[model samples]
Target: MELLKAQNIEKKFVNHLALDDVNVSIPENSIYGLLGPNGAGKTTLIRIINRITAPDKGEILLKGRPLQPEDVNIIGYLPEERGLYKKMKVGEQALYLARLKGLSKRDALKRLKYWFGKFEMEAWWDKKVEELSKGMAQKVQFVTTILHEPELLIFDEPFSGFDPINANMLKQEIIDLKKKGATIIFSTHNMASVEELCDHITLINQSRNILEGHIDDIRKKYKSNIYEISFNGEVEKLEKSLNQYYEIIDKTKVDGHSAVRIKLLHQTNENELLSLIIPAVEIISFKELIPSMNDIFIKVVNEYKN
Candidate 1:
């Protein structure tokens, strides 16, 4: 079931159309990636969903019903621009924000203690936010964002300041949240994170949704029928075995074995290429090369511009 749906969403600001007839469906208990370059209207759409601003056209639905003001209670949003009272003690600010989300003091403290200990943040609770490093402050805000345990969690550029270790920790926590039934909308420029965490995605560009679908399906659709082979054979003999159907794009040595990347042309299949090459050289390993999300992102955006 879809946890959230924005249909025919359109937003305009005085002279600019920020979002144009955009649509997105976020499934329950899944991580949905919101992607696009800067000025692509992704943030505008996220604000609309958060009810920070109203759409000029179209309606948003939460669990098949028209979204309600009360629905904000069930949604947790961590904006791209971090906001925390710099002079306030970490624990104090966290408790305050949790209360704003309707958690009682007793409940808030219990959860805060648990998360602080988990993130090894207990030592910093008494310290002021301004004293913390960017990454540390971000970790504090992250804890507060999910403190209320909302059903829908929206993270915009959630990994902006973290080192590799903290970033990976955040990634694991996000995966755990999904396992425990939280639906997440992750927005970021990191295509690698999208590949690792997103089950589905919506790519917005030029004030429009240019792409939307499962990650694997999108990759498969954009594939060029290229394959990489590794074998301990003479490169000259391997070159002699292929016909016009195969175009060798790259050749290199991997761990003392010769490797070559071949692209199929004119309806050629890997089996046929393997058949021709198997007899010519010893076949050690063969695998198709799929386009990365970063490649697709650039390809689609550029194609749209042209």
Candidate 2:
């Protein structure tokens, strides 16, 4: 089921269009990546979804109904620009935010305590936000965002300040949230995080959606039919045999072994390629090379400019 959807969404600021005919459907209990370079309208779309701003020419649906201002209570948004009162104690600010989300004082305290313990942040509760490091403050903000168990969570650059260990910890928390029926819309430039955490993604460029789909499907769609082969063979003989059937993209030798990458031109199975090369080389491994999200991001963005 789709937890949230923005259909043909368009947003404008004065004379400039910030989002143009954008349509994205976020599935229930899945992490959807909202991606693009700076100025691509990623933040604009997120704001529209959060109802911080209205779309110029489109509609948004939450849980199969038209979205409303009241729906904000059900969403937990951690914006790219962090906001916390620097002079306020971390615990105090957390409790205040939780209450604004409609949690009672007692329940808020319980949830805060649990999250503080979970994140190993008990010692910092009484400390002022101004005293905390960027990463520590981020942890406090994260706890408040998820304390309400919101049905929809929007995280814009959620991993910005953390070290690898804490980032991994947050990643696991996000996965856990998905398992527990929370749908998340994550916006980040980190393609590595997208590959690791996102199930579906929408890529925007110059305020237009250029690509959208399941990660694996998109990867497959953009595949160049490239393969890497490793084997031990007389270099010249192996090259000659492979040249007969495949376009050799690269060939390198290391540690008494040779590796070659080939892009198949004609419809030929790996077995067929193997059959031709077996007598000439000892095959060690053969694997297809799929383009990574980083590659896809650059490719799509470049195409948009052209």
Candidate 3:
């Protein structure tokens, strides 16, 4: 079911349009990637949903009802701009934020202890926020964001200062959250993370939503129909073998064997491709080349700019 939806959301700032006729629906218990290059109105739209700012025109619905101010309490937001009081002790700060989200003192402490232990930050609870590294501070912030177990979690540039190991750890935790029935809205410029974690994505460019859909569906829609073929044979035989049916786009040697990449024209089928190559070379493997999210991101953004 759609947990949240924005319909024709429009927002403007004095002389510039921040969002223009934007619409997107986020499914429950799924990770939705809110992607765009810097200043594409992604942040503007997020603020609208979070009710930090109001849309100039359009409506936001949470669970099919007009979103109200109190809905903010049900949302866990980790903004791209992290904010933690520098002088506040880590544990003390976390407890305060949790209470602000409507948790009682007892419940907030109970949840904070669990999260601190889970994230292995229990030992650092007494340290001041300024004493922690950027990544360390982000970890504490993440714990507080999820401490109340909100129905929807919005994370912006979640891995910005994280090292590879810590980043992967956070990714795993996100996946685990989904498994435990949390809907997530993740905003980032990192295409790799989108590829790995997002089930669906909406790509915004120049304050306009340029693309939106399930990851697999979008990838398939943008497919180039390139195929990679590996065979155990002399290069000459493989070259001559491909002459009959498929058009060889490129050929390379990999691990003492010849590999040929081909793009089929009309009337060319996989069976036809295999039929021509099987006789001339020992077929090792054949697979289609799926475009990566990074490739799709560049292609879509460039198209929109032009």
Candidate 4:
């Protein structure tokens, strides 16, 4: 089931088209990545979805109906730019935000305590936001965002300030949310995070959705049919056997076994390649090379520019 869907979404500023005919569908209980470089209109689309600004042309559907004001209750958004009153105590601010989200005071305190304890932030609850570090404040914001258990959560640049450990902690929390049937739209420049947490993605560039699909399918779509073969073979014989049928992209020797990353020039099975090479070399391992999201990101963006 799709939790949210956008069709022919178009948004423009006074002189610039921020989003152009954009369409994206987010599946229920899945993590969807919104990826693109700066100025790609990622934030604009997010704002449009949140109803922060009216779209020039298009409509968004939440849970199979046109998005209405009531649908906002089911969405929890953590914007790229974090906002909090610096002078306000962390606990006070959290409670206030939770109440605004429609949580009662007692329930808000209960959830706040649970989240604060999970983050190991009990000691700092009474401290003012101004006294906490950037990462600490972000943690507090995260708690409030999820406290209401919204059906859909949108996080933009959610890991801007955390250290490695806290980042991993947050990553686990996101995965847990998904496991518990909460759909998420994660927007970040961190390709590593996309690979780790995203089940599907939409890549926006130059006010357009340049790419969108399941992560694995997109990776396979851009794969170059490259393979790495590891074997103990005489380097001279290996080169001669390859001899134009295979394009050796890289070669390395490790642990007495030589490995070469080769691309096939024509249709042939790995067994056939093995047949020709086994006469001169002993095979140890063979594996296909799949392109990473980072590689695909650069490749598609570059192709579009050209």
Candidate 5:
């Protein structure tokens, strides 16, 4: 079921249309990727959903009802711009933020200790925020953001400053959060992360939503009928056996096997291609070459531009 829905959301800023008729439905306990290039109004939409700014038109529904001011209590938001009191000690700042999120002092301390220990940050608890590195500060902020265990979490560029190890750690935490029934709206320019973590995505471009669907379905829709075949046969013989419906896009040697990428033309199906090639070569493996999210993003954005 959809936990959050935005219908016909529109936002304007002094002659700039930040969001135009943008709509998205985020399912319960799933990670929804809010994607777009820089200045494509993704931040504007996120802000509107967080009630940081009001929309000029349309409505936002949380759990099938009109969103209210109190709804923010159930939402955890980590904006792209990180902020913390530099002079305050790490533990002190975390406690302050947790209190603002309505957590009891004892409960907040318990949770903060657990998170800090898990993140190997026990030593930095008493240190000032200014003394920590960017990645270290980010860890503290992340812990505080989800300290109250909000049902809905919005993370904008969550992996921005972390190294590969820390990023992977954060990724696993996100997956764990989903398993624990938290619906996440992850906003990032990282397509690889989107593919790895997002169950569904809405691609916004030029202040409008251009694509929206499940990751697998979107990849299937954007596929180009390309197939990769690894067979033990001569490249020339394989090339000659195919009819005009097949076009060889790439050829390489994989572990002494001739691997070739072929594009099916004129709506030629896989069965037909296999039927023709089976008699001529020994088929070791065959698989469709699905386009990645990065490819689809570029293709869709360029098509919309044209």
Candidate 6:
């Protein structure tokens, strides 16, 4: 089931079209990546989704129905720009935010304590927000973002301030959230994180959605029929065997094993490749090379610019 769907979402500023007929569907219990280059309208679309701004010409649907003002209570958002009051005590501010989300004081305190403990932040309870490090403060905001147990959570650059240890800790928690059925819309410039965590994604470019699909499917769609073959044989024989069917991209020896990367110049199956090369070299390993998200991002954005 789709927890949220924004169809034909359009937004504009005096002289700028921030979003143009953008459409996104976020499935229940899945992490959706809201991706694009800077100024490509990712945050504009995010603002629309969070009701921070109304679309100029589109509607948002939540849980298969028209989105309502009250739906904000059920949707948690942690913007890239953090807004915690520096002078407020960490635990006090957390409880305040939880109550604003409509939690009772008793319930808010209970949940806040639990999360503080889970994050090993109980010692910082009485400390002012300004007293903690940026990463520690982000941890508090993270706790508040999820304290309500919102059904849909939107996080923009949530990993910004953390070290690898805390970042990985947060990543695992996000995966855990999915397992427990919370739909998430994650926006970031980190393509590697998207490759690791996103089940589906929408790539926006020039105020438009240029790519949208399951992560695996999108990667396959952009595949270039490249493969890396590891073998032990004379490089000269391997080169002769490639002929016109292959384009050797890079050849290097890995820990004494000969590895060669080749791009298929013509449409050919793995069997055909093996048949052509088996007689020339001893095959130790073979694997197709799928273009990484980083490569795909550059390709798509550059093409759009051109």
Candidate 4 lDDT (Cα, whole model)? 0.92
Which parts of model 6 are misplaced by more than 4 Å? none
User: 45-126 in candidate 4: lDDT tens per residue?
Assistant: 9999898988989899997899998677778999999989999999999999988888899999999999999889999889
Q: Of 3 and 4, which scores higher on lDDT?
A: 4
> Per-residue CA lDDT of candidate 1, range 141-182, in tens?
999999999999999999998999999999999999999999
Mark the regions of model 1 whose C-alpha exceeds 4 Å error after superposition: none
- lDDT by residue (tens digit), candidate 3, 119-168: 89998899999999989999999899988999999999999988999998
**Residue 44's C-alpha lDDT in candidate 6?**
89
Residue pairs with colliding backbones in model 6 are none
Candidate 6 lDDT over residue span 1-306, tens digit each? 788999999898999999999999888888999999889999888888888899989899998898888888888899999979999999899999999888999999999889888999999999999999989999999999999999999999989989999999999999998888899999999999999999999899999999998999999999999899999988789999866878899999988879999888877778888898999999999999999999999999899889
Q: What is the lDDT of residue 284 in candidate 2?
A: 90
The total number of steric clashes, by the backbone 3 Å criterion, in model 3 comes to 0
Query: Once model 4 is optimally superposed onto the true structure by TM-score, how far is the C-alpha of residue 293 displaced, in angstroms?
Result: 0.5
Tens-digit lDDT track of model 2 for 1-306: 899989999988987889999989999888999999999899999999989989989999998899988888899999999989999999999999999998999999999999999899999989999999999999999999999999999999999989999999999999999999899999999999999999999999998898999999999999988889899877688777765558888889878899989888887877788788889988899999999999999999998889
The lDDT for every candidate, in the order shown, is 0.95, 0.92, 0.91, 0.92, 0.94, 0.92
Evaluate model 1: give its TM-score.
0.95
lDDT of 5 by residue, 1-306 (tens): 999999999999997899999999999999999999899999999899889999999999999999999888789999999989999999999999998888899999999999999999999999999999999999999999899999999999999999999999999999999999999999999999999999999999999999999999999999999999999988888898899999999999988899999999986899999998998889999999999999999999999999
Runs off by more than 4 Å, candidate 3: 242-245
Scored by lDDT, model 3 comes in at 0.91
Residue 87's lDDT within candidate 5 is 98
The Cα RMSD in angstroms, rounded to one decimal, for candidate 3 relative to the true structure is 1.5
Cα TM-score of candidate 4? 0.96
